[model samples]
Target chain A: MIPNNISKLIDAIINKTEAKKAIWGKTSRNEEFKLFLEKGAVTTDTWVENGIEAIDFAIYNSYGDKIDNFVAYKGDDDFDILSRLHNTAKREFFKVDETIENLFKELNDPKSVGKRQIEDDTPLPF
Target chain B: MKKTISISIIGVVGIILCIYFFEDSDKTLPNYATVIGTICSIVGLSIAYINILALKEESIIISKQIHLTLEKVNQLNSLSEISKAIKVNQEIQEFLRNEKIELARLRTLDLKYMLLHFNNDLLLNELTSDEEYKKLILDFGIDLNSLNETLINSKRKVDFTKVVKNLEELSTYLTKFELKLKSIKI
Candidate 1:
């Protein structure tokens, strides 16, 4: 049986991952996603790949060799194990999505946009 | 003093020539005297015209020098403003490192305005060409956006080592840019 603490941690990770995935699905089409990729130095494909790799690494570091046993043990359903693992990867991938979205909003604020326009329009006296 | 002396000499010479031409016993100016007076007047007028032209040329040179100096001053001013913005950004980074989220957020807003002003100053002074300016804007925007992300993530207990590294890279780039601006010769 999975220990209660480990099970709890996995649940938390899965929940966070699902939340992030939903947000990413909504935002991946926006212009800010491109900006995020540029600043974060990851293309869309690499970002997803990296996210999965990070989740795997985190799981390994946290569980060590026991992760295999946790997966193989019949105490947990095979489908449940796979679903949890998938959600964990998604959570890792979407970790910074909200942060990037907030940043884009701050930058694209109307006040800032208007200020830039005014500056561009003003003529130099010289 | 030299111009006054020359004018005085010319005036005395004119008076003497007038006297010489008019002192004929018949009290009439001779043809040769009239011709000499006309020649002298022509020569004096030509000299005056040449002097005026030289003065005009000197004024133009002075104006151009003034213009060049002003442009250099503007360049330096824009660079200093950029330096100030960089310093503020450094402070924001420090605030982030210290876990001062609210302070960093407030300062980030200030830095945004400063960056805007810096961009305008750069454009006004023509420090960077349009293409170069666009590239610079992209670079800075990326850095600032990353900084913003770091600030936001800090609230959620996210590891910020990567953001800090990116900020350091930006700081290095900005320092190099500052040096490049300083090296520009008018």
Candidate 2:
């Protein structure tokens, strides 16, 4: 589970972004947060299914600005540091699992990961 | 003080009345005793509730201190990392390679310091021994790890040579991020 404080922080950041004129529904930070909110604290979950991909989403999203905004690390040595990061990618993967599981139980109708669907059907035009 | 005294007196008097005069007559004595018992119970519960409220206030104070500590640590680390990353040029990759040993050494020392702080602030605290504390620390470590990787991946995927004909391109954006990280405090 995301620490309530961290969750609040992410919400605050999103709120800060929301006040601005952005074309996105949820800011990148909010999207990263929606990853780890699971039904329970621990157990069989989504991380076990797609570990690397889950963490990659969070990392890339969180670093989107730094990655694109700065080019200092756009080199071989930088790649070395990033490769080291993937080794710990399991954390984000677990977050994804937890988030999906949370939504499942939150709706009070557990379903296979593939069968889960969000209520918002409309896509953002932007 | 008046409430306390009244509750106490009401409680004791009811106890005394119930003891001798009211004991033999269960009907009268028990009735009087119930009134005293209720008053004493209410007063006791009120005092205990007040104590709990005080404790909650104290905990909020402690959590604030911890937050301040975390902010200080993050700020120092963020700006230093920004400075380290920002100052380097197209030749930074090769230059950093030469100083890789020192960089790794610094990282090791920093990790040791972090571990020490975590042990003191988290492991030594009452909650430090708790499972939740352990999980929190572990998750924090994992998050930091992933952050390192994201930085690497983003830089690796991009073609630097295309933009690195001069230092101006890299320096322009690096300074912007440096300002962003150092928005107010250096």
Candidate 3:
């Protein structure tokens, strides 16, 4: 089950995505990319060659670790590389979704960081 | 309309009198009076028919003119709205640009303080070596070099050029629309 804050954040993201398929153009991927964007994903344009389009994106976990991903689509025929990039970014970022969720849960917890059970010597796996 | 109807009625009466007068004229010797009357009556009839047609055409032209005027007014209104949008976009773009630059500057200052604190902490405790200090700070994800580099590379240029261009295009279109409207006869 999603936490109350998480659920509310997701709703805000979804609500802000207006006619996603229309604005971004239709793609086979689900609309999860919008959520990833809202969660602080950064995308950059890459070089295109020989009817191929490319874009790169960096997704940051709550711990500030970056996951890089790229999407390459055919430039010809109404193909939308931006939407594809979003989907790829989201998918790559999802690999560490559990860590991110745990981080958020820890942050939202009532206890301060000093009062937490974590030991000073304990290394963070982030 | 009443004047046109009255003239038409007079024209019909004139034509009837001309015909009645001409009915008695000998075919071999044409009657000058009858011919003159007939010519005058025919001219009058023609003028009355032309006048009525002109009135109808004038009404149509007036209505068409009103429509064109309304369209012109609407286009002007749209141009004003677009101008307002462009103004707002420019203000927002400027604000965002300044805000980003300020934020980046502040972040760099914060990072410098963090580094100073780290150095101060090391000085107070003389046991830790330089490499160990660097490693401990790096482990905590506070790479001063990377952070400084990022701050140097950060750009805060908010581009509202495309939006401005689009609005300008719409303005141009409205100007052209106005020109087209002016060229219309109605």
Among all candidates shown, the one with the greatest lDDT:
1
> lDDT per residue, candidate 3, A1-126, as tens digits?
223553354344334443232122211112222222322333323334454544433334322234443344455322343444444434344534557878899999998865558889999899
lDDT (C-alpha) at residue B137 in model 3: 27
Query: Stretches of candidate 3 above 4 Å error?
Result: A1-32, A35-89, A92-126, B1-52, B98-186
Local accuracy of candidate 2 as per-residue lDDT tens digits, B1-186: 565566567667766765547545565756766866776787788767766777899999999989888776775665565455444342343433453423433453344244334345421244334444343333333333323433554322222232232223334544554465455442
Model 3: how far residue B142 lies from native, Å: 32
Candidate 2's TM-score on the B chain: 0.41
lDDT string, candidate 1, B38-131, tens digits: 7567657766876887799999999999999997888788778768868877887788789675776677667667655655554344533334
Write model 3 residue lDDT over B1-186, tens digit each, in one string: 666566667766765665566655443245656665676677677777878798899999999999889766754554454344334434433433454434433443443343334243322233222343333222222122223323454321222342233323433433443344344442
Top-scoring candidate (TM-score): 1
DockQ, candidate 1, comes to 0.02
TM-scores of the models, in the order given:
0.44, 0.29, 0.27
| By TM-score: ranked, best first | 1, 2, 3
The sequence of per-residue lDDT tens digits that candidate 2 reaches over residues A19-65 is 44211211112122222221111111111112232322221222111
Per-residue error for B103 in candidate 1, Å, reads 2.2
